[model samples]
Target: MSAKPWPEGTGCRILQEVDSTNAEAQRLAPTLSGPEWILAHRQTTGRGRRGRPWANPVGNFTATLVMQPGETPDKVALRSFVASLALFDAFVAATGRVALFALKWPNDVLLNGGKVAGILLESAGAGGTLSHFCIGIGVNLVAAPSRSDVDESAITPVDLQSETGARVTPEEFLDLLAPAFADWEAQFSTYGFAPIRQAWLNRAAKIGEVITARTGKESVVGTFETIDDTGALVLKTASGRRVISAAEVFF
Candidate 1:
């Protein structure tokens, strides 16, 4: 098979293995001239939110894009929505089935209600502005960990190969992903979060369903309303609508 192609002017480094794409991105960010992508065939110490272990089998997709957003860290954080939408677009394009996938709140991509991918955004610099940000994404392309392999309480994992009954390599997946991400990132730059927010709600998983959001300290149960203007999750409870900026969601 031929090598996968990336978008024009985008720099990429593909590794046989790495500690973590995000960590490598952070280490290389200082010398990168522009937006660059770091991809690894396998990760020895991958991680997810809250420092949970992220399983990175050889055939799955493990990559990170390092860039300077030129905005406050809080503003750049909204790129999570952008990244989620990009993954949705890429998945649909790759599988040619829009009905099989959904975007979960915060940063997860689900297939038939089972997670197929996860997104993690980490940044450097203090105060308000961010010097650089690493958007790490892990997609289960050829293999997925069993529930037993990860924390038992975590959501069951899904793989693209099993769902579509076709073989897809990590490189093929990234070819579709890179351009989709660029498109969404451009839209976000020109139109702000309004369009991304609307697109996300359109593909959102379990909106309007009764669900629970678990903040580290407490859990809030309510009907999933919609995401507000600022991207906070809006949940309707007996009292009123509560906007949550960060939490683990369960439906």
Candidate 2:
């Protein structure tokens, strides 16, 4: 009857305040298109997986790209690496150097010894039915939240390479990420996800090393195997192969 209040297409919308990009994405659901909307500047309500409160600060790069409809929900796990790649490109482009970015399983981006970027995807619709996915990304650009506030260790681009005498601004970072999604989205649709899976593993940290994994109820130490073709992180368990859809990994 009336126009639904949502952003149109091809550009990312910046917001100064919101509960969370993922949450806002939920609100925009039931009527979403691939306009690639983002609400990041400050999130009064931020979230990590499994109800963990993410420390989302202002003046950083945080966004939620609303994916197109009709894709199966479970398959969206494959999209996580695409988001990771987008952030990785932004990291390298900003710093103008190689090896400046790395992945920490499922979806955390690490720079130096601390965190610089995080990727979150939320679904809106029935499990087996057609659905839209919101890919939320947070990249620290300027200031850092209090170290004491971080549940686990975290770092930012500024914390690592600020000595370069030229800092990457939020605008510049977002500019890089927008075109990145455009490029990666094409690859994801045409070739499925094998290429991205390989690329992610190549840049993945501790792929062959044993690491600690926390999945809310239990914490297990296991050797990190490569990500399977299905996009689930494979851990070589003592019993056999254990595929993880979501977990907080640490070294």
Candidate 3:
């Protein structure tokens, strides 16, 4: 178990089951005074980005961190990077293997080049501010979905136990992740996204390597470049530099 203590002013609640942690965050946002971590051992209706169904096998880790971030939507969205760094730290702490992990662009963590975790961000508000923001995280702790479960071009899913022989529970993983997140969040709140962007870049996957970014409209193939200050994926394409705000990256 991680010796890391929980963050101050943060609330944590564990549920035996839920529809989805993100959904629960939405329901609890109105009543929450500070940040809260909602963890669910089982999710009946878990979903991912673009409303894709999330496969949550037994013994995996699933949770969401909800907060009433008073920043602009763009700023709030960048918290995905913060969450990524936290996951990286927690995974290393759990497995004692720092070199095996990498952070994928936007929001995914790779273990030995295979996907081991994913992050989904959801928020609601108007007038250029957010009422609440939730960062939903799902980690393959003990078991992963079959190869046929994901997209044809997607990276294969991997489990921590299968890969590293680490048997961390959902609650234990949360214990490590919550404090790590709070630390990165503190940096973000104090110094802004510059340091976070640099730190994330240092741990990013496929840097300077050829990759493909597919959006709803088209696919752009280019060398993986640095993420811009606004958290857009910057790629050096054949024609010119392309700054993609959103896309499905394949490497």
Candidate 4:
């Protein structure tokens, strides 16, 4: 991997195969002196939100960024939005198309209204302060799983190659992504989540439409309002505005 595009104090390792980049990042976090990245060409045991199996076939982008954010859990959680914006920018730069891509609430990248990428965040800390965080990202580059391979209610998967008719290798995607992420991270560090939130709102998937937010126990159906100050999804129900920190959103 080329080191020129990466941020200062960032270290990276590329592996041909791994059980999961996040797991590897966890093992390295305690010993890391600075920000580090772990990239896997193939992940045998990758996972998504709620421990769902993540398919990391060869040629897809599978990587984990491990860093010590040194912030409160609420602030650290905002990285998901930051990462999503970076991913959106990177995909647009790689494909040179801005119309087909949108960012789902919280942290999923949609291509032509289909799920093309997902973000998973894991952290270890105590007393509301984060010691380290692992931001695991997976993007479908060459191929996407069939509808039968995923949950029936989940959005159909889409791949970059199929949508753009241009071959995009994982390496090339990461090269574009690394610099984009650094740019957003710098913005987040300087201006806080307000700027990031506004940027996210601009590319949000269904801002004014009614959507369903399933939070495991119950479901809330309401108009998709803006995200709140703390990065919660604000939904306008008949009763009032409801904020959700985590849930499965369906449009």
Better of 1 and 2 by lDDT: 1
lDDT by residue for model 3 (108-166), tens? 99999999999999998988989999999999999998999899889999999999999
**TM-score of candidate 4 relative to the true fold:** 0.96
Tens-digit lDDT string for candidate 2 (127-160): 4864677888776676655667666433333343
Q: What TM-score does each of the candidates earn?
A: 0.96, 0.85, 0.99, 0.96
lDDT for model 3? 0.95
Q: Can you list the residue pairs that collide in candidate 3?
A: none
Superior by TM-score: candidate 1 or candidate 3: 3
Residue 112 of model 2 has an lDDT of 66
Instruction: Answer with 2 or 3, whichever has the higher lDDT.
Output: 3
Count of steric clashes across candidates, in order? 0, 2, 0, 0
lDDT of 4 by residue, 1-251 (tens): 22236677788899999999999999989999988878899999999998999987789999999999878887888999999999998888887789999999879999999999999999998888888999999999988999999988888999988988868787777777888889999999999999999999999999999999999988999999899999889999988989998899998
Provide the lDDT at 20 for model 4.
96
Candidate 2 RMSD to the correct structure: 5.6
TM-score, cand. 2 vs. native: 0.85
User: Against the hidden true structure, what lDDT does model 2 obtain?
Assistant: 0.71
Candidate number with greatest TM-score: 3
lDDT of every predicted structure (CA atoms):
0.88, 0.71, 0.95, 0.90
